[model samples]
Target: MPDGGLDPVIHAPARLRVVATLAALGPGDELSFPKLQKLLDMTAGNLSTHLRKLEDAGYVHVTKTHEGRTPATYLRLTGAGRAAFEAYTTALTTLLRGTAS
Candidate 1:
């Protein structure tokens, strides 16, 4: 009714980028922290903050493990996250097409 309302949580620029990156991964696939940081061109602390927000919202699943004594962080989108992203895209498309519903 409001031109396909946008998701406040995913509307932030940083959060949008994070969600988009995660959405690009194949189903059940994950991206490493360093990879994400490089891809997004974000600082380690900045990326970590955004990840924490997404994780807190249950939109992301994070796994921390050791790879040859090096800590590795992996991030994946949850089913709920995938669904929310889909809806967000749909709403954006609808708004862009000037079809407000």
Candidate 2:
């Protein structure tokens, strides 16, 4: 067995946190921009930058909508995102356990 490789895209700290947060949500559940920002304790610009990277990787789906008079953004993990996150975790776990696959 060979060691599993880590995914650079999902390995970044900020992006990893974002993906992990989304993975914890229930299926079909999404976190609004404000909520996610507050939860992660990140500034809007920082979160947006990381999210853009994830979105470009097809790991997240971001939707914008108007809530009454205010604009709102929502983010959810796509199937691909979930699978990638799972793989990343598995690889990390294997590495920690000194195991190879």
Candidate 3:
């Protein structure tokens, strides 16, 4: 959603849902992988694939650590990500409004 355009990366349906969910969190807040998966109703592999793409695009930050013996993965949107999502929404809204009768 940079340069006043839609982001093909975030435009994908699953990725859009992921970004929307993460965007709902407060800045610097994080969501556990399981929690996000449950929230989005996405299988582990499906979510992982999309997340990997977002991370590669520098829109998502993924952290891996240990909670006792269990491994934990947490996700948050980067500043660029926040900006991109904002732009995406603005563009989408504009597009929709233009089409409204």
Candidate 4:
């Protein structure tokens, strides 16, 4: 979006999708990396990159461990992240409504 245009609450499509998915799940529920990848239909590398961005932004928390033979990665949203996502959705809704009117 342009500087004068509406500053979107969720700027990146993939990030928005991630946040939206997390919001749909029960609060504090953690999603495994592979599961989230399947849900988003995103590649491991791509998902990792997006997740890194979210992690850096303090929107998501990542945990890595080994489940016997395989490695596991889990993601959960932070309180601030959840609140920001909610605000963004609300802003988007209002903007869409204004345009419709």
Candidate 5:
């Protein structure tokens, strides 16, 4: 994004939902893949695709682990991501208010 513009990386609808959900978590908090999938009501593949994009953008951090015989994925928004989301919201509000007047 350039100068108060919305970030393309965080602007897509599905990705936005994913970011918004993760942003709700407290700092240092993380969510497991299955739990996030349930919260977003998204298919594993769908969520994975979006997650990959966010991860590539340096906006999200992903961790892979094993729980007994099972594999688990955990996700959290990074500091840059939180900052970007905050900027996005502020820009969106400004845009909306501009049209309202």
Candidate 6:
């Protein structure tokens, strides 16, 4: 939980999970759509919809490319996304700290 309630912009379940996963990866790291779908245990369509939402909010970057004869999609978090995620974590930490007193 966070103070003043979680920011809806980052509080969305799918979006929150997406940001958490991205935060766990290395810098300049990226994940493929299929890989992410598997990791999140979500349907392709479901994951696609979530990803689109994140992309629209400038929280994630989606890249579509061709790999020989096949299509490849990569997802990564933007700088703004990273900052927001960090803030979310910090808020959660602060809230927990208050409870620990």
Better of 1 and 2 by lDDT: 2
Which should have the higher TM-score, number 5 or number 6? 5
Per-residue C-alpha lDDT of model 2 across residues 4-94, encoded as one tens digit per residue: 5778888989999999999999766899989999999999999999999999999999999998999999999999999999889989998
How does model 3 fare in lDDT? 0.92
Clashes of each: 1, 0, 0, 0, 0, 0
- Tens-digit per-residue lDDT, 21-49, candidate 3: 99999988999999999999999999999
lDDT per residue (tens digit) for residues 61-93 in model 5: 999999999999999999999998998998888
**Per-residue lDDT for 1-101 in model 6, tens only?**
44444556778788788889987887568999989888999899988888888788787888999999999999999887888888887777867778533
lDDT, candidates in the order shown? 0.88, 0.91, 0.92, 0.80, 0.92, 0.81
Cα deviation at 83, candidate 4, in Å, is 0.4
Clash pairs of candidate 3?
none
TM-score of each candidate structure, all chains considered together: 0.92, 0.93, 0.92, 0.85, 0.92, 0.85
| Candidate 5 lDDT for residue 22 | 95
**Candidate 1: regions farther than 4 A off:** 1-3
Candidate ranking under TM-score, highest first, comes to 2, 5, 3, 1, 6, 4
Clashing pairs in 2: none
The lDDT of model 6 is: 0.81
RMSD of each: 1.8, 2.3, 3.0, 3.0, 2.4, 2.7
Candidate 6 Cα deviation (angstroms), residue 16: 1.1
lDDT, model 1: 0.88
Of the pair 1 and 6, which is ahead by TM-score? 1
Which TM-score value belongs to model 5?
0.92
lDDT, residue 67, model 3? 100
